[model samples]
Target: MTAVLSARGWTGSTFRSLRTRNYRLFATGQVVSNTGTWMQRIAQDWLVLSLTNSPTAVGITTALQFLPMLMFGLWGGVLADRYPKRRLLIATQSCMGLLAAALAVLTLTGTVRVGHVYLIAFLLGLATVVDNPTRQSFVTEMVGESDLRNAVSLNAAIFQAARLVGPAVAGVLINAVGAGWAFGVNALSYVGVLTGLLLMRPAELYPSPRVARARGQLREGLRYIAGRRELVWPIVLVGFVGTFGYNWPIILSAFAKDVFHHGAGTYGVFNTLMAVGSLAGALLAARRTTTRLRMLLAAAAGFGVLEVVAALTPWFWLFCPLLLVIGLLGLTFNTTANTTVQLACSPEMRGRVMGVYMLVFTGGTPIGGPLIGWVTETYGARDGLAVGGAVAALAAATVAAILAFARHDGTPVSIRSAVGTLTGRRA
Candidate 1:
């Protein structure tokens, strides 16, 4: 009886966020849409590789896809604070659907060029700049602050589950029909999310206080982060890892073609395996009620170590399992950092805080993707992977040292205190 009760308790804690109807709706819709998004990502990367047969070109395509976020992500955060998030999501989601459809048409018509791919990628990035921060901040409305961490972890799980399914399906589709149909399928998947958004009951939402129009709001947000060590350290860690560590598309593409001599099917298998670990990590995170900086740092360091091990593995089979461990550690780090940052910020500043977070996390991709690609092309895929792993491990070590030194020096600085101060009042 005790064991049965413990099992039930664990299950309930793992899914507590789903008790909120709005979050349930959001999760259901995201499962479908996220799958479709992953499908497109796999198809797109494969298509780019096929067109140019150059890993560097693949890197360039990735750089273009995320460049807009580097430029407009902060302003996108500003818009999130100023506008209704649900309404904004509808617009962004619609535009993304249209863009996916356009890419599908281009691919099917046999008129697709590298330039066309580059342009569409850039446009999609523009939409993402607005979409990311709003979506990050929107969760508080669905489940309120009490359930925000659980909701975020569940969302990560949903995304990773989709990643597991989408790539495998995309690989089969790409192998059987072509990449065009995968894009078409992705375009249609947007309807699920839009429908979910439209169906939400506004009365059920716990709407956060919106900031009024004010000059220098962006600077205000920046200053808010600067004053908080908890926020600053996590953001800095993410920037380094995100920029140098997460260029998987480039790394995987090179590995698939150059190292493994495999086709799209093999590439998809690799992604699915990685997602398995990520999904596990997300579920583990969901079971916990709190986030910790130590967990984030340890996971980041583990992720780097695993990547290096994977790079050194001579056999494709050996390398694939290492990616699973890497995925687990990477997702654990990301979810912890994401939850910590969101919970630390005031609701009014959540949008901008998330915007800066997303900007640093993804914006660095433009610089890192191309550089990693060039490295893979010039040296080898293994060497490129090694470099990324080393950088991530070193970054984690650096941050850990800083935190330890501060603590040992009798500094009153603490993440708990930083969070208390940030969320205690509006910026």
Candidate 2:
């Protein structure tokens, strides 16, 4: 009977979080909008590449989209703590839709320039400065703490699932008609999210009280994280891993082109496998009722180790399959860290915490991408993966040791013994 219960929990449908009416609506809208978002991403890139024929132009567009999050993400989190997330989401989502619509119009009209693409990309990034945190913290409001982990997992699954479908569909659209129609479809996708927001019953949401306007709220949020060990380590782990480990675009493409001796086709295959593993990992996370710090450490370390192993694999078939395991570990680390951080903080500060969480998780990419690219170019793809994986694993182990090195029962714990216990072994 115990085994049966365990099996059921492990394999249960991840869609259980969708049982809440408000969340169900919100999620429904997100899936549609996310699909469109991914579509626009591919089409936008294709449009830029077509205009300038320069990979540098493509990189700049990518950088512009993420720069706002790095710059204003904390401020966005501050706003989330100060206002209603639903209203904020509504405003942000609408702005995003309008931007997509404008881009569609520009592209379809045959007057679009690379400059136009760059400006819009930056503007869209600006919207996400608020949207990312508001959307993240709002999950707790939608489902409360009991179901928060499940909801977060479902969110990851949805994004990855859309990721799987969106790019392929966008490729078809771009090839069949043009990038313009893809943008148009993405613009229409906003209707789903907007309708979801408009229809959500305000009374059902478990909102944190709005933060009073204050001068030092940002510093307060930082201090909140600083004093708490649980919060600090997870965010640090994400920063190390996100910056060094998650730059797959640079590392994987290099592997496919230089190592595998294939072109865009192999690159797509590697990405698809990664997405598939991520989706599976997310579903696996949705089944567990509890989130643990130990799980985060394990997954983070495993992710790094797998990258090292993947980098050294000599055969193409061996390298390809390793990516799936690496992808799984990557998503597992991400979801665990996300759930842990959100659960560890106070309701009032959830927004700020998540904003910081996202800032490190994504903002590092700009830094990591170029650094890893240079490493890959200078050495090889194998070295790039090995170096990134090593950093992630080392960060995970370091955090574990830090977490373990505390006094217990009025006695000091040695680092070696503490790390062993923290990592789930008896010393």
Candidate 3:
């Protein structure tokens, strides 16, 4: 009876966020849109690789897509605060759909070039700068504070679930037709999101008051983060992990084409398996009522350790399962970091806080993508992945030390002892 009750409790929690009507609608749209997004991701990376026969070109595409986040992500958060999230999302999502359509037309018409890809990627990045933060902060409006964490976890799960379907379909599409069809499908997927957004009842939303336009708004957000030591460490940790540890498009593609001598099918399979693990991790995260610093740090360390293991394996069979574990730990770290930052800040500041959080988290991709791509090109895929894992692991340790320093009472404790205190074990 006890076991039955426990199982029931866990099962119920896994989909608790869907109880809210608005969230259910939002999620319904996201599942389709997210699936399309993943399809595009796989298709885009593969497209770049085929066009140039260079992993570096793939990295350059990635860099171009995320470069705007490094430049204008925070301002996006400012807009989220100053405007209604739903309305902002409508505009951004429309822009994204149009961009996808344009790319599809180019690729389908046989006039596509690497230069055209670079430009479209940059335009998409511009749309994302606003969309990312507003979408994140909008969750608070949908489910309120009580279910915020669950919604975030479920959102991750939904995205990963789509990932499972997206890449597989993209692989088939690429093989049977061409990459252009995948882009076309993704462009159509936006209809789901737009429909959901349009159907939402304005009265149901828990909207934050719009901030009046003022000078130093951007600086204000920075100061808000600077004053909170607790908030600072997670951002720092995610920045390093995101920049170094999350270059899968570069490393995995290189492994598929150059190292394993496989084609699009194997690449799609690798992504699907990782999506399986990511979905599991997100579902597990949703069941939890709270998260601790120890859990977040542990996930970060595990992700790094597993990436190194994945890099070292010479057998193709062994490499596949390693990606699953890597995906699980990676998603765990991301969801925890995201929920932590959001829960710690006040409502008025939530948008900017999430913006800054995403800035470091994804903005660093531009720098990491090209560097890792070059490393793969020069030293082989194995060494490139190993280098990234090392950096991530070291960054996790550094952040752990920072946490120790911040939390230590003014006692004469060694760094090791302080670290032990945070991890609840002897260092």
Candidate 4:
């Protein structure tokens, strides 16, 4: 009975990419760790607003948290290639867990100040500088060529699934026990992931070569990307969309509270619905063995359309379900764009390549968050969403035009099939 239950838990699909035990272990840890990470994120944001009632201040705080990624991401990519990914991840995760615990203590004791949150947020950002690229490269190391796409998609799916659980629980816990309790729960959540990482069979992990590149290799990474149209364009797309449109949660949190006059519980439900949509999108991507550029392009456009609809919807209750659609199409575009870049890059260049990819995805936020905040503060919440959607639409159209002019002969992908794959419609 025990074996049967265990087998049922690890279904054929769960283990599809887990012939490598290392991946299975990593996935298990991530499920726990990522959920905690999301919980902490929600708690932190709420805590910030509780301390400082300014929307601009919250945006600035978000900016500080991501600034390290913008400045040090290339260096982080270099570090990933220089060190063991698993070792780096273990250390980073431990540090982050401790940081959460410390914050919990401060907040619970009523000694927490806005300045404390800023300092801690900056430190956490610094840790993430190294953590993000290492984790991205680690995926390929675990699954190899056989199930790389599946692993990536599944990884995203779990992240979104945790998104659903984390904020909901955090909202309830914050209202009941206090925000400190949410942080404590998050601190505890890291234990499961850390344990999974430690218990993984080392032999099942893929061998990664620590290549010695010349000093000033950041420029080299830039030059490498400059020459590849296929690689560079998608990264650009992600940067624009991610920086602006992808900031729905942070922006919408304020909108829901200040503009719509909703409670924290309603805010949690809004995020939960978006997560549901995101999970569906990730699962759809996971089922596909290959990705197409056209699909990514179309999904990008669809995301913009959904965002516009979400922004224009008059009532809070009416706006909620549109967020789910936005989440769905947004993930579809994002995952396809991400997987395409990974599959296209050579192993030697994966870390650096993904660094630039992440740079665009994350780096845009520092610029976009402020702009969106300004719009939300000055014009209104609807204006912020509408403007972001417009930017996304334009970016998508630009990609379409490029696809029309470029010779895609060298690449396995073309414009038509790519669009069909993204929409899941007939080619």
Candidate 5:
């Protein structure tokens, strides 16, 4: 009896699910690769800003990087469903690594043109169109349903934890070694994730049966979401928050330099501080086994409200701490929404569901970044942040009202119970 009990206990260990070996390699590789990814992100944004000294140019670069996701994410989802994710990821990651290396070479040689940046940015965005859904869905293939939720939260935790370290390190590296070095590091970072994918045991992977690739697959994913009001509403909330509200950094970057009267080093510190709060939120999320809708709604509200306060503050010190709060609330909302949507869908539909999820969540950035950039350019940074927060808050409120009406009609999203799942407390 003791032997049986011991076996059962061992089976339930958190890392036990990773005993599959393939997942262990995948997770390990992701950690290293994701850190490099973050480093490049910091470097890329800084490089564009230094080259142009125009907020709109930075916004344009950001838009180019995400526009492909908006255009191709749904199709990417179909591919994820219809093909072997491992093979697809190998192709896409290789493309991205090459792009990163090329960009580093351009910048390092002092021959990088703005047009060159724009073109490469667009190509990178296009690759991400394939990469995002494939990667999101790949989590399930790696761990199966038994550990899917934990794996998703852990993925976010790992991503943001890298955020905690990567930006600060990038700041130091950029200041000391030049942005090209950061890009070079990013190119090398792809090696870790690529190696992990190569090492994963094919036999242990969850087999996704290929579906007939069809026209109107994006519509099918949309219709699947529409049938569930809960699912639709959270996605709506994310769309608003991601597109407009989450552009705080872009807005704050301008304000930090102009309104708050600071410099690049100060800008780096602000980002790092936000990462600190975001890391805390991600860690808190990792403790949960299941997710609910109400929690998502509440967190979305907090995310918007915090951004509003952060914008309204007059002093740099006051506003910076508020950005930290905004970061914490934003991650709580984002990670919860991400985990909930993934959990609510059927395993077979996960690729598509997550495809739309990534589309709305990330696709918004391109549209929002430029729009917010225009706002900052026109009205100044403070107004941009305030307006963004206001819009996001209004969207959240609208979704909440729609959700209430849906419940009156005898429909509620799984998110309705999200709060209880995390805290074991009822509102």
Candidate 6:
């Protein structure tokens, strides 16, 4: 019996978090909800392209969707710490659903305009400012710290898996019915997550202490991050990569239309193929027991290099395989950074720390998206991709060098240390 049970546990090790009832429910709900989310994403991007055949317009839409995170992301973290995360998610999710529904009505009624898309995207961004942090921190409540990394990896896997399905389905719907139907489906999909939240067994939750109300808590969170080299470095790296490296929606759409001379169906295929690699990366991450700084840095650099090479590929057939590699490295870097930051922070401060993480990661879109869009618009798609890739690789190298200097000095590295090392002075 002991041997049999041990074998069973080993067989289930990669999915250990699902053994917890709460995480299981959360994961199930998310699978459905995430699929819908991806569908809407594909549909929305296609809709913008249809409304205005400019990649710059699509970039603007992406930027608007993420702009609120820049403005309110940290405050969202404060709320995550102050309130019950599950309840917070319900409110945010509901708001997002309604927004999707409203957009669907506009599109289906033939009243949708570029202005309407921008308005709804901004509204969705506002909801996500709260939802992103709360949903990220809530994993700890569902599955304790012992299994947190696994749970995070599993979450990424679910998201990528949804990516595989959602885009394909959305492509078909967009071609046959309309983009509006995709939005309508996404609006309905929120019910699954909301229902799961309601069904959760509160007693089973591994609750962390709610942060006591206090002044300057946000500043405290910032100070905490400033002091931790592990947290600070990864966050900085993600900011650069996230801003310049992960503008796939724009890049892929440009490739499909301009380079490949294809339509929404081909765009969907690219996304789906990329997700295949992403899902592989996420599953691989799930098997790892720890997050390493070296792995994060290496993956980021590799992702950048891959993108650069992919940009230079002349044929769509060649581009597809390159996207697979890019997807794998991109997801690997993302999962490692997310797991590392969340695991490194104190429970009381995880929300705010993650808030900062999300801010740098998504908020940078406003700055990077338009710049990349302009590059693509002015120079061409390949040049735009190359620019982003070069910047991402350069950022990784800079962070890696700083980290090496810090290690050599046997201290947590900062800007001062980097400057001192460069100038040959004591830091």
Q: State each model's CA lDDT, in order.
A: 0.89, 0.81, 0.89, 0.79, 0.77, 0.89
Worst 10 residues of 3 by lDDT: 1-10
Instruction: Give Cα distance to truth, residue 144, candidate 1, Å.
Output: 0.7
Best by TM-score: 1
The TM-scores of all predictions, comma-separated, are 0.94, 0.86, 0.93, 0.92, 0.90, 0.94
Off by over 4 Å in 1: 1-11, 409-414, 417-427
Task: Give the C-alpha lDDT of model 1.
Answer: 0.89
lDDT of candidate 5 over 159-209, digit per residue (tens): 766776777777888888788887888899899889989988898888766
| lDDT against true structure, model 3 | 0.89
* Per-residue error (Å), model 3, residue 46: 0.7
**Which run of 10 residues does model 4 get worst, by summed lDDT?**
1-10
lDDT tens string, model 2, 1-427? 1111222234345666676788878878878888888788767766765677444455567667778888888998999999989999999999999999999999899989999998998899899999999999999999898889999998888877776777777777877788998899999999999998899999998998789999999999999988766677789899999988987656765676678877444555676777788888988998887667778888999999999999998998888788788878899999988988898899999999998998998777667766776677778889988999999999999987777564243223433344344555544
Q: Write the per-residue lDDT of candidate 3 for residues 1-427, one digit (tens) a residue.
A: 1111222234486777777778878898998999999999999999999999999999999999999999999999999999999999999999999999999999999999999999999999999999999999999999899999999999999899999999999999999999999999999999999998999888998888788999998999999988765577788899999999999889888999988999999999999989999998999999998767777888999899888998999999999999998899999999998998898888999999999998998899999999999999999999889989989989988887776665546433433344455555554
| Runs in model 5 lying further than 4 Å from the true structure | 1-20, 408-427
Total backbone clashes of candidate 2, pairs 3 or more residues apart or in separate chains: 0
Per-residue C-alpha lDDT of model 6 across residues 1-427, encoded as one tens digit per residue: 1111222345566777777777877888888899999999999999999999999999999999999999999999999999999999999999999999999999999999999999999999999999999999999999999999999988999999999999999999999999999999999999989988999999999877899899999999999999776678889999999999999889989999998899999999999999999989988999999666778888999999988999998987789998888999999999999988898889999999999999999999999999999899888899889989999999999988766854556543444454355456665
lDDT of 4 at 94: 88
Residues 272-389 of candidate 4 have per-residue lDDT tens digits of 8889999899888888876777788888998987788878888877788788888899889888988888887777677888888887788677788778878877887888888899
In Å, residue 99's CA in model 6 sits off its true spot by 0.6
Better of 1 and 6 by TM-score: 1
Total residue pair clashes for candidate 3: 0
Superior candidate under TM-score, 3 versus 5:
3
